[model samples]
Target: MTAPDSSAPLGVFDSGVGGLTVVRALRELLPDESIIYLGDTARVPYGSKSPDTIRRFSVEDTQFLVGHGVKAVIVACNTATAHALPLLQSTFRVPVIGVLEPGVEATLSDPNCERVGIIGTAGTIRSSAYQYALAMRKPGLQIHAIPTPLLVPFVEEGWTDHPALESVLHEYLTPLLDKGVDTLVLGCTHYPLLVPLLKKMLGDQLRLVDSASTCAAHVKTLLEAQNLLRLPGEKPTLDIYLTDLAEQAEALAKRFLGSTFNKVKKATL
Candidate 1:
């Protein structure tokens, strides 16, 4: 067990650079606490993998972050959050939070939201993670899920907007728009890059829901609930680790993290 007074970083890990979105939101909300982020870039998209593979990778990712002295961990990938959250929470000694549950809670707690649509990769949509969570929270709410595999690769390429994006957005989102969804959940972390285009595609009639901000707020609340907030006068730090792809990692880091990080290092795990 970790020591009670441990001042270790809180860990967040995802399958690729996508999780930088989550890290960005967390940094804004908890400016005084250090964060350790791990991106298993070599494996890239977990959206195509099987449940067993996702669970294995998730456990390994969490274990790798725990080795870096994190007191808590967040599974920032929707796929992992769907398939591996239970394993992570039960196996890890520290508190483990997944993006899916908190995001569902946020959507459900907001009374204005009645019909919600979800856009994500195949795995997240197929897992029906968001739907299950939403049904549990608000049994009668309508939920639509559309699988979007292209968005992840687009975001990874640092191409947030292009002529191709609009067509893709319209193709993937038109059904949800026609369904008259009031709130659309950007179910994948990578989807945030397309917020502007998606909003335009859906028009002012539909509201875009970002799980990143909600998940970050929940992280803050979780820390406070457990009395794990950072100590006074401590200089907050952020350490980023990735599996190879140093250049892509750096570019996305700058895109989401806003500032250049001199502390980023490459690691296999």
Candidate 2:
């Protein structure tokens, strides 16, 4: 395989538009680096799928990104990262980064973080990727992980501030709060959109570790270490691709990506 050029765009993929949150973060941190994001919207919500299915889908997603000549690939979906990151790293020539490690590193970066609570999809929580990683790095650390499956749909529906969402948040987070967790990791990329509501409900004490932002920072570090950072003075561009473009894709993209939302093209894989 030829070496990835510094001028090549970084590739990022998720089960759906949620990965745009990562793109938003990347745009802010590495303004000169162009990005190619693919959303496997046709197979949205890989969380409930079997591990084998998730791995297959993730490989196809990475293949699509690699075909586009991306410098690196970011598995932005927590479920995919949990199940397929190892396979992707071994299979791909370009750097493969997952959202899990960065979030784990950020959570442990807090010296006072003894008890940590993680909320993600069923697949992510069931796989215990975050839980295992945390325990491995900080032995004896108290870790509580729950799968808040409904939260993803609510976020994608743009119901972030809906009254019903408050009830769901309480249902999901009350147990974690009761455990007296000092930190909470937003394991899913889509969860960041709920941060405002989360802060409003949980208030100032709970330290929220956002996977999207931390993953973006990690990507920047990796690119720099490998001398793949894009040169300055070149205007960066973002290209979005979706396997299935729903009618609300544009609105959802805007919701997750804010001002950085770009027109999405259809992806075959």
Q: Write the per-residue lDDT of candidate 1 for residues 166-190, one digit (tens) a residue.
A: 7888788788888888988889887
lDDT per residue (tens digit) for residues 139-194 in model 2 = 99999999898998899888999999999999999999999999999999999999
lDDT of 2 at 209: 97
Clashing pairs in 1: none
lDDT value, residue 170 of candidate 1: 78
The lDDT per prediction is: 0.84, 0.93
Highest lDDT scorer:
2
Candidate 1 lDDT (Cα, whole model)? 0.84
* Candidate 2 off by > 4 Å: none
Worst 10 residues of 2 by lDDT: 255-264
Count of backbone collisions within predicted model 2: 0
Structural similarity to truth (TM-score) of each candidate: 0.94, 0.97
